[model samples]
Target: MTRHILIGLIALLPVQAAAGTIGKSEQVQACVLRQIDAAAPVADCVNEAQTECLDLVMKAPMASVACFRDARDTWNGYIGDRMAHISATAPTELAGVAGIEVKYDLLQNLMQCDRMIDLTLLREDPSEATEAQKARCEATATALAYVKLLLQSRNLN
Candidate 1:
């Protein structure tokens, strides 16, 4: 679980870095405020997205799988709720591109979380685990690629 948290946190490092340099759009901020006001578990998602949890997974691979499984459940819930909100409230036009981008990013993260769970459950031996990890990594890579395409479409319009 801790390892999963670490994995997520590690993934978020770039986001955290970019967050400070770029100002978020009003639409995105409004979405966040709504989530917070609704007391969604999204805040816990951010808290776990820090780098401090990575060592636990590195030290104990098998134990880490269990933790990853638990973490997946929490992440699944957060992503589901956020996706629902975004689907309902997200803007579809160019001026709302930032909000749409935020939704795309969240969708990518949701795919990553799904892959983490699949990798953990499919682990049998080191070789098999490696294969599973490769597959899961590919899934996330595909999601990111798609997100890039979506953003490009948004910008092209």
Candidate 2:
């Protein structure tokens, strides 16, 4: 009887993990699209677009990290290439606009959190993370929450 119960529990693990990941992915995508629509100016638009792309990277299921990483690298590369072209061709008035730095350090930190989530998903072992990793992940999550709030505030104006 104990053996049968253990087998059933083990079988349920994959389903639970998949369900949690899918919910998170959907949430990330929804938040991203909303941000894109709220953004103003070309720079803001691109930054928001990149954020959306990163959200996809971070929210992808752990079972699919390789695919997610590939897609993200390609997407970020394309954005970089396009920005280079814009830099070469843009009018002087618009040139400064292109270089406007978005909050990238914060975004990268958030992506790291997403990567940690991917690891957790695959391991089914959230407790495996070191204390430092946990603190960094929590900080990233808090930053993202604040950024989302700031974006929403812009919509009000």
Candidate 3:
């Protein structure tokens, strides 16, 4: 029994680290930049914070929604930085940046409309969770859009 307890405690060490990871913008930047330096795909970093938040919350829905929101904001920041770099270095890419911004807005709007119908209409008792779910949908969509932009930025270099 003591051995089992000891193993369980040891397994949770990473969980403790993950708990402190979410909402730290600097951490997200470092994770992405490290992957870029290593020539690994930075796509994984886009979801790193969300994954850590989900692990910390044990898959609770509301908490998962918050994770998506945090992921959206962090990814957005990274996307903005990348775009600014492209615009500064390659001024000819202004049209490309504008196109990406339009696509991102459309992606978020479409996702919220399509995925949120069930939460808002089909549920027997629609509570505040419905709005929260919609918000999560938007955030998830925005993160997805940002991921695409970040991937494209790789080709600009």
> TM-scores, in order shown?
0.32, 0.32, 0.53
Task: Give the Cα-based TM-score of candidate 2 against the true structure.
Answer: 0.32
For TM-score, candidate 1 versus 3, the one ahead is 3
Q: How far is candidate 3 from the true structure (C-alpha RMSD, Å)?
A: 15.5
Q: Write the per-residue lDDT of candidate 2 for residues 33-142, one digit (tens) a residue.
A: 66577773323322343343235433443423433333333333332333344445655444333333222333555577777777766856554233234443533343
Tell me the lDDT of candidate 1: 0.39
* Per-residue lDDT value at 20 in model 2: 24
For model 1, residues 32-111, the per-residue Cα lDDT tens digits are 44555788743332323312222334565544444333333333333333333433444444324433454456557667
Instruction: In model 2, state the lDDT of residue 13.
Output: 21
Best model number under TM-score? 3
For all candidates in order, the CA lDDT equals 0.39, 0.38, 0.53
Query: 135, model 1: CA deviation in Å?
Result: 10
Candidate 3 error regions (>4 Å): 1-47, 56-60, 93-115, 118-120, 128-132
**Clashing residue pairs found in predicted model 3:** none
Please state the error at residue 95 of candidate 2 in Å.
3.3
lDDT of 2 at 6: 29
The TM-score measured for candidate 3 stands at 0.53
Minimum summed lDDT over a 10-residue window in model 3 is located at 10-19
